[model samples]
Target: MGTIYRGGSRGALAGLRRPHLHPVPSVADRLNAERHELAGAACTAADPEVFFDGTQDATDVAKRICGGCPVRARCLWLALEHGEAFGIFGGLTADERRRLRRKGVSAA
Candidate 1:
């Protein structure tokens, strides 16, 4: 049988890499994380493609869904703060969000 030895020294750990420490989550990360826990959020049940499709028809449909969304404000704020340049968020297209940002709108 091979010999088994025990030592109090940390020499065995010398070649092991230290655990990587992640930085604090950004605002986008926190928003998205909380979004999942949000009850009655409109987008939870809808197809994701509706928001990403660039067609006007899709935009109309997405906007309609967001019209009465309980969390629309938060959704819009997340997209706006993160500078998301694509998709329909909180019933507004990327261009619309750009306009709002230009006008100094920080939240929904």
Candidate 2:
């Protein structure tokens, strides 16, 4: 007589299920993601007053810092997404970003 298996047999189900594999992100990818974050930004080290300043001199200073930012596009996109009402982002003031949104132009 053949051996009977139970409905809850662990051995039968174990072999039928395949192991799930997830690809690990490379160091470069991790670095890139980190680089785009606010913490890694040039503006992070800058005085907060400069970003929110309405004066031309302060705005220019903030823009100069943003001018060479590697993650400028990402910064702009985030600012737009969050509807940031103050500060300079991606070399553009809050008003500028708002205008771009009104024009249907994204940070890209």
Local distance difference test scores for all models: 0.59, 0.57
lDDT of 1: 0.59
Rate residue 30 of model 1 by lDDT: 28
Which parts of model 1 have CA positions greater than 4 angstroms off?
1-37
Kindly list the per-residue Cα lDDT of model 1 for residues 1-108, writing each as its tens digit.
332222123332111111112112322232233445556777666665666567888888889988988978777776676666666667898899999999989854
What TM-score does structure 1 among the candidates reach? 0.63
Clashing pairs in 1: none
Please, what is the TM-score per model?
Answer: 0.63, 0.60
TM-score of 2: 0.60
Model 2 misplaced stretches (Cα beyond 4 Å): 1-39
Query: Which tens-of-lDDT digit does each residue in 34-93 have in candidate 2?
Result: 333555577656665566557999999989988988778777776665555555767898
